[model samples]
Target: MITVDEIKRMLPHRYPMLLVDRVTELVPGERASGLKAVTCNEPWYEGMPDTATEEDYHYPWTVLIESWCHVAGVLVTWDRPNPDVRSGKAMLLGGIADAEFHRPVVPGDVVEHHVRLARQVGETYVFEGESLVGKETALTIGRLTMTMRPASDLTAPPVPDPL
Candidate 1:
């Protein structure tokens, strides 16, 4: 099992961008299961200076997709034996297909993300990932294609206090 503190070693994303909270299961070229605990303190909640309430805070669809991508990236990295020594790679979101959102995700939700490698051709890894809030599915079967970049690209500092 990989906790949020451990995930920081593999990815350079910091607070507000670092999405995955914990990685429970990982299998190389197979599948991975990740956990994310959403909270009211999420930086996205703070809007402009005039914002009085969070009712207007909207979680963009693109950001949600990015979260999914982060899950997939963690799976791939954790699959390796020595993730720390590795230069740290970047998974570019090539594309997303057959994506459907059933409901909105609010604060105080523990979302489980399951990502499996559906197939791989050349450098592209095709994966099927979904997000669930308890028993209810927030996202359905969706396809994601990501291309790996050299591990040297992760130059940013580690994410802090997001668990």
Candidate 2:
């Protein structure tokens, strides 16, 4: 069982951008299952057309793709005991294979991401992931090919105040 705090240690994502809320199953070198509790307060919800009136907005295609990638990364990155230098770093999207969206996902939905390791070719780890909302499969298929990168690439340096 992986808690939100434990997930923080495994991946560099945080706050608004961090997607996975919990991890129910983590089988090293095989698969992983994660949960994302989507809510109306999510930053993306504000820009959605139907969100202003409290109606469920059609989830953006890009965000759905990103979410799939994030979960895939988590599956691969957490496959082994994390290395010291790898902590706080992120898995960069090296490529994608067979990515296809099946249905729409809306707000107030609990998205469950299931990822399986497809193969590791050279420096890239390939993962196939799917997102489900309740009994409906919102997204049927996608693959994330990723390589690890420094945390600095994902974070901005602190700006100093005027003296």
Candidate 3:
């Protein structure tokens, strides 16, 4: 088991935004499995009104995908850990394709994301996998691409809104 502390040593993600809670399994340069325990304490739930219904509490799909990506991030960077993006190459999501959500994730759910390295070319990596709640699959990552770029590349000023 990789504690959240260890995960912090691998990825630059931090709390609330640091969706992955712990890594249960990891095969460096190959595959990994990690967990995220959803809870009402999550900042995303703070905006709820007193009238909010059960549907309103379902974990946002965007956050779910982000959580899964964090695990994949751990897998690809395990062999070459770079927690600080200021010094070494940093991993960035290049693309997400064919993702399918199987069920609604609620506050009580514990999601386990399983990620596999499908292929790698130069600094780019292709990963495939799924997330599960209990024994049932919760989401499928049909294809996700990640790339390694020099830390300096990530320092480019944010693009201005076209509006």
The candidate that wins on lDDT is 3
Candidate 1's residue-wise lDDT over 1-163, tens digit each? 8888788766667777888888888887899888888776778666446745455544555666677777788766654522433554555666778888876776777888889988777656788978888998878656887766556654643222111
> Model 2, 76-139: lDDT tens per residue?
6664433343454556666665677767777778888888887776446767778888887777
* Best TM-score among the predictions, by candidate number: 3
RMSD of each: 7.2, 8.2, 4.4
| lDDT of the candidates, in the order given | 0.71, 0.69, 0.85
Question: How many clashes does the backbone of model 2 have?
Answer: 0
| Model 1, CA-based lDDT | 0.71
Better of 1 and 2 by TM-score: 1
Worst 10 residues of 2 by lDDT: 154-163
Better model by TM-score: candidate 1 vs candidate 3: 3
Clashing pairs in 1: 88-151
